[model samples]
Target: MMQENMAGAHLIWMLILALVVVIPFWRICQKAGYPGILGLLSIVPIANIALIYFLAFARWPAHKSVQQDPSS
Candidate 1:
């Protein structure tokens, strides 16, 4: 019984930690003009590294559409 309770507590703590890490990563992806769903890739070991490299080098969609008028 005690072992089961300890395992349950460990699982809960792990879930909380995952959420703490994933939520901000999701927001960061959104702010960078990527889909928030992409943040879930961070949960994967190798894919998370790829995602970081892609984010760093890729052009942001939000910034790609800005127009400057010379007449203004």
Candidate 2:
């Protein structure tokens, strides 16, 4: 029926939207030096939700530069 088709279409669209939103955040988490596995954490219960919020806002530590200061 037309209603069934429309529901299927809506489901697909929602899935696409979810991927669009999650992929970039995954990339961002990696860019911020978090483990790639963190992306999979998204499937977990409440923890996953919390992790995403943490990743989106937390300022992770930067990679330390190796060059030594001559003055020290």
Candidate 3:
């Protein structure tokens, strides 16, 4: 009984942690002009590393548009 409770708590903690990571990523992806769904990658083990690298180095569509503006 105690083990089951502990396992359930662990699962809830994991879910909470995933949400903590995902929500900010979702907002960031939207602000970057990328699909918000890309934030789901944050919950994946290997993909999270790839996501960070991509976000760090890849050109953001929003930035591109802003840079292309003649008014800027």
Higher TM-score: candidate 1 or 3? 3
lDDT of 1 by residue, 1-72 (tens): 999999999999988988887888899899887899888888889998998899889988756654433453
* Colliding residue pairs in candidate 1: none
Candidate 3 residue runs with Cα over 4 Å from true position = none
- Estimate, for each residue in 1-72, the C-alpha lDDT of model 3 and write its tens digit: 999999999999999999999999999999999999999999999999999999999999999999999996
Candidate 2 root-mean-square deviation in Å? 4.5
For TM-score, the strongest prediction is: 3
| Winner of 1 and 2 under TM-score | 1
What lDDT does each candidate get?
0.85, 0.71, 0.96
TM-score of each: 0.82, 0.58, 0.90
Best by lDDT: 3
- TM-score rank order: 3, 1, 2
Q: Quote the lDDT for 62 in model 2.
A: 36
lDDT of 1: 0.85
